[model samples]
Target chain A: MSDMSLATPRAYRRPSTRRIQVLALLTALVAGLILLTLSCGRGCLAPGDVFAALTGAPGADASFVVSELRLPRAVLGLVAGLSFGLGGVAFQVMLRNPLASPDIIGISASAGAAAVFAIVILSVDGWLVSLIAVVAGLGVALLIWTLSARRGAAGARLILIGIGISAMLDSITSYVLLEAPAWDRAEALRWLTGSLNGAQLTQAIPVAGALLIFGGLLAFTARDLEALRLGDDTAQALGVRADGTRLRVTLAAVGLVAIATAATGPIAFVAFLSGPIAARLLPGAKGLLLGAALVGAFLVIAGDFVGQFLLPARLPVGVVTGAVGAPFLLYLIIRANKNGGTL
Target chain B: MMRAERPHRFAGFAILLGLLVLTVGLSLTVGARAVPWDEVWAGLLGQIDSIGAAAVAVRVPRTALAVLAGGALGLAGAVMQGISRNPLADPGILGVNAGAALFVVIGIAWFDISGAQNFLWLGIAGAGLTAVFVYLVGATGQGGATPLKLTLAGTATSVAVSAFIIAVVLPRNDIAGSVQSWQVGGVGGARFDTLLPAVPFAVVGLLLSLASARVLNALALGEELATGLGQSVALGRLMAAAGAVVLCGTATALCGPIGFVGLVVPHLCRMIAGVDYKLVLPLSTLAGASMLGLSDVLGRVVARPNELDVGIVTAFVGAPFFIWTVRNNRMRGL
Candidate 1:
């Protein structure tokens, strides 16, 4: 083992340095994106005005736009984005399949479907919707888990089954939206894909709570998860319980994603894209949960800004991320195939 | 072996055709407003003096469209699965439906394109492009188009294309309502004139699909073996794929991207007809038509006063079967 460690010494030493640099860079990028989101909407606000408004511009128009409108929107984006990123990367790492992110594997789709059904059919509001989503999300994960547990590469089977499941869930969302009263459609559209358009500070609370609790659990298991990646037997030999780690990771990831999805719809591939980007940024790095979280936050905030201000027409943040994600998905598939489906 | 199997296959085909006829009858009679069985016969005979007869009159074109579109999608799916040699290959799963949808939406949005002819062309072009692109991306890897790789590529393309569609449709409220309903995949408002344009394409596609069954059987014995038996594997795959694309694009244009009719039908047919593509293809068409017709009838019956679309119904009905297939089959080397 010592000889093995010594032979690949550069793998450890090099990534340690790169991880710090990369995480720091991602943090800075996320911060910049948050600022950008806060400052721009219908009309761009100056940096001074944004800071001033955030501080105590109670009666001013800039203050309302910044504090009331933009602040909640930014907070939701930050929390939801981080959660999506963390959950996405954790699932990918746990499953050892790059394509097995929660968004692609029907977790987010089920959550979004639940949220839509709650809002449209049940006429539920706020936290109840999120609760339904989280439950439904876990239920779907369980269903897929039991269904795809045949002997073979469970990871590949999980993705295929998830695709089938997601198709059904997505169509449910559409059907609800279609049956939804005209007044509900504009809001229900967010459930089909994610959007931060009617941002509310209240919506961020449950999501942030999920982030803190689930995110903490994921961080605790990160080491064991990295060990499990080396192979289950090796992980077991190293005193790590593979099943325990998988269960914790699955719970945490599903919780994070369900809450985030309920708050801001599924947000279209933010969860799907974050982990791969983080992996690319810090190649050979083991624990990418934090880096992916930051990347997720960056993509959400930046995507929202692009949809709101960069494009001629105002679009949802999900649309922007979806556009970016599709090409990246293609690139990843081609690359993963070249490497025999291992990233 | 052939002699022994022929009787059973023919019996199975007869049953499916009988089911298809029953489904049409059910579709004609059962709806938000139920028509008497005797009245349905009169309605079919063009006596439209009463509401029941008029309702039956309304259902005639819808039933036809559903059958044709369902057959088209089911046949397309069988050909795709055959050519790709992957059970999961369907026009919807393989990005052809999405490709057709994106093109038709674009044509409506940008070119202000109208009429069935224009929609048909745009949809076919889009389906063809997506098919070619997915093939290039999926087939280029070391193993040449494995099922998993191709599926991933197709799913990604579908995801991306849909995002584009949402971006296009969101801003324009004028087109959004119409486009949104269309996207839900229904045969509700289907009319004879509007349905006519697709018949030619559907017939051509049907002929091509039926003709390719022998080629599919040949190709199914592994490419090298098929070639050894004097089959031009490339030509056969291309012709089959083209037929699938035309059928899928045409069906998508008419029905607005109904999924799973193709994916589930062929699998069910294979169970009934065995692995013989010749037997499976025709059975799939009949079975596909029956399934869609039943779905449409179920949609109308389940949600009275506010009918659900066949597309949504198929999705709900087919998804369980899809999960079952995944669980039962091996994902590798199939």
Candidate 2:
């Protein structure tokens, strides 16, 4: 409408992929990282010890450390990663804007804000946090959608509106945390930095189940999503029912993101990074859904490990991913700006 | 949105000044404690004998800081939009605040820097550098610094910077409390001693912005046309942006980064004073001060014993307004 043109640029992709080999390599690599996290902690354990601990072997010494401490945390990371990856890519694909990832746009902010409110004000815990986060995430999406839809060309407007909304929500989150009567370190850290320091095996269950249901929902619409990346007119011409596809995908993706955020506290930019990283890793791959999901898992396992060991002081996964993702995002923006907004 | 005739322009200024007077009054008298009018007057005269007088005394410097800082942010935001020709160009929205935060945070974490003057320079430097970086990044490729592109670039930078700050703060218990205020802006801790160092900087920045009004006007008519009219587009853009940076940098250094005053005030002023930078800039200053002063009062009153930060108050008020602006306007660039 003004000087800047919102001519939507399309990224080229299809179901075409390097296929199973790349996917297998990423899975195996992620598995190795998870195992590595299991082995190296306060005291190192051999792969032999880890294997026996997993199998409920007799006289397993580090069984609690393996099954309780490390195992649930790893499972939480892996499951939450998949949720973020799947959810993030779905939005980017549907919106055709990398910056439209849930984290940047305010869905994740809504969840984090809700989580903080629940913890500080309501003094709630467990599944209740998950429930509130999920509800808030969907509500924010609707809020952004309704507000942005008031104008012409909702694409760029939506993301910009979302950013504005996201800032507001973030301020609320910070304000509540600051005024929190009882300073709970873990509760504060979970909302502030997205940590896995106190992951419960119980927490992993609902998140994994969320990944399964919402991820499956996303997968069912995967083909239509591919058609979406080609833009709305072209997709409709190919009988893709663009609006229906967008609505369903958005709901499913928001659900995935909120549920995972409730469990892991919006693990900073995993959702933002996964799609683009996976697309690069498996070049020409359409429906980068599975690949991106796996990348999310890999990033969490690897990021948590780095935060735990590589850093000067042990940090949260969100902090590590945020630090890593920011530079990559800048690179993408710089390159895209140079290439006239192309990926 | 047409040019204001002479009479309407005069009326606009009068209305704005009157609004400022009202808000300043509200800020002085209304707070956690309801100070009577005579006591507020007595408090202004340095009498702190009564409880209401003492409460009024405590709020005076805070109110002063709110006015000055709010004016700086609002003026900065107007100049930002004027120079960039983007409606979305607020200090906070553009990630300049984040940049300032990054430098001040680094200074705190590594060097253990203290004092307002030290942070002022760091904040200005960071704000200036980030402004340049975001502009370059946004202005790259075919569409140069489109509103959407710039906003996105700023958003990404802000997100990245926040992560970095959290990382630095999380590990060290010592610096964490100090940085928390920087993360969340407020004037609750306002003191004249702290406020005094910032006044000269704020005045210079304010004058510099007001002085560049004609140059900003000339450049508004496309870069080449402004050059055709013997105006230096790059030089003018830089000068105006410098004033904005100084203003925002000083405000941020003083009160952390308060969002939305810069964003909301300029837009409101434009609605009142048209697109003319001279009218917009001054009007934004008054409106911003009024808004922040009133918000500070609201913050004090709303929660009773506890006070909400002015930054949080503005966020609640401004974000919806921002979203509304985005919705009503037809924007391009993704």
- Cα lDDT listed for each candidate: 0.87, 0.84
Weakest lDDT window of 10 consecutive positions for candidate 2 chain B? B325-334
Where is the poorest 10-residue window by lDDT in model 1 chain B? B1-10
Fnat values, candidates in order: 0.62, 0.66
- lDDT tens digits by residue: candidate 1, B231-316: 88899888888899999999999989888999999988887778888888889889989999999999999888889999999999
Number of backbone-clashing residue pairs for each candidate, in the order shown = 0, 1
Candidate 2 on A1-343: residue-level lDDT in tens? Answer: 4333345222222324355667889889988888888888877999999999999998999898999899998999999988999999888877777777999889999998998899789998888988899899989998888877643333677777888888899888887887886975434754576888889999888788888888888889998888877878999999999889988998899989998888888788999999888888775645389999999999988899899888898888888898889877776666664222422
Candidate 1 runs further than 4 Å off: A1-14, A58-61, A182-187, A337-340, B1-4, B331-334
Task: Give the i-RMS of model 1 in Å.
Answer: 1.8
Write one digit per residue (lDDT tens) for candidate 2, span B259-297.
888999988888888888878889999998988898888
Interface RMSD of each: 1.8, 2.5
Best candidate, TM-score:
1
lDDT by residue (A1-343, candidate 1, tens digit) is 8897788766465777878888888898888888877887778889988988888966556987888888999999999999999999888888877888898889999999998888878899888988899999999999888888776444567888899899899888888889877554545554467999888999999999999899999888889999998989999999999889988988999999998998899998998888888888885756588989999999999998888888988889998999999888888777774333644
